[model samples]
Target: MSFKNYISKLVFCNGISNSFKTFTALIINSKRYSSRFKKNTLDLNNNETFVYHLKSGKNKFKFYLRTFKGDIDIFYEVFWRKTYDRHLSFLKKEPVIIVDLGAHIGMTSVYLALKYPHSKIYAIEASSENFELLKVNTEAFKNITCIHAAAYFEDGMINFGNNELSYNQMISENGDPVKALSIETLMRTHDLSHIDLIKIDIEGGETELLSRNNSWLKLVDHTIIEIHTPYTPSDLRDDIQPYGFEIKSEKDSVLFAAKK
Candidate 1:
């Protein structure tokens, strides 16, 4: 983080006046500064990205991204809007293991890492482009491990297609080949005996995933997923309820399931 980039993030997140106030606070009251910053975007690597700067106690974190509509909406939804807080309210255990599917640029992973700093998190992304930024954002946290693979029902190469909406990329027959890992495979690769929280937001592809050979549900205690078109709430209920998850949908278009 260079001085130029630091000031740029300050300006992008907080306006000039607030940036000045934050700067002065940092220099004058460095030890007492709590994270009350701004939200805005930055132009980086020929793409626009959302930039947010925060300080927790004596440590500082910057979530910088390079993306399309995905950056703005996802960042706002996860950070300012508190999209997952409701779904995640049941997480009372510490030192838990988490797997994040469709971890686009790692906003959710970053948020979760901060919320559960002692927990281990695997942030998985399919797109090579998005994974780069995901790495950058999650690097500040030691608890987050990033994987470049799509969480499909099978463990092999699969067709990964893009969408006009940057956040909704999915596996398709017409798409390019990418490494596909299953829930079982992820657990095995990470040597995870059980997962405390697993997040799935792979567009509409969850229908196929939940419908497929999902014996892995036995190992998952809690899951939260965003439902897309053609994958209704009934579909989600029918797929996971038999596994004994008390399923409910939050207002922001996501379903959360926890073991009874």
Candidate 2:
């Protein structure tokens, strides 16, 4: 086999060398940077995007994505470069209440803070490891309040099943071991009446969370959820019609919805 094919077989099958993955990632990032450099040099228009620096490790530096239309987080460059107009269309003028459920590492919070400067964002993350990074990442944004709790259908603390590094946010429905509170109760406790955008990514708990509280529909306007129903037993949209939400868009495992 070819040299590249040999490397792929070793990395894909045996999976012993993380160095292979790191080298591949570096190559991909190099291409992306090259493309960005070419675009910035060529596009000398009135509405050009400028990059900003972020407070992260050398590998993951945050940036300010500035175009003629508006400014957003640089970490969201992929989202902005691909469907910048589509995302911008969702921007609302009125003061919005954003609920970022399962806000892994505060990407959505940081993006929302830059996207909607006047909005109030409550970012909930369960994993202790991720919460640590989320805190530092979102510290500069004053409009955001980071809550380190796993949201669920009930209130109380619960034990989280430790699994893969990314799946650390998954929790039980009732919320024991992992600190959790229902959306309805969270609203009442915080004295929040209107929710402009509620983004939920609680593994496969979307069905249970919605089924338990039909009244939550009245409080939420828009929702972006990551559904994790890969195999049987955990169909993401099995009984979601009662919640009064229409799926607007979906890519990979994430679904965007608007209350109808």
All candidates' TM-scores? 0.79, 0.64
Q: After superposition, how far is residue 215 of candidate 1 from its true place, in Å?
A: 0.3
Per-residue C-alpha lDDT of model 1 across residues 1-260, encoded as one tens digit per residue: 47985555445444312345444433332112111112323222345444556554444676664433446557656765578988787766753898999998898998888888889999999977788889988888999999999988888898886544557677777777889889888889889999988999997778888899898988889999998988888888888888888885466578788888
lDDT of 2 by residue, 4-78 (tens): 855654443233112444435433443454465556642323333333333322223333222322122223332
For model 1, the superposed segments whose C-alpha errors exceed 4 Å read 1-46, 49-52, 56-58
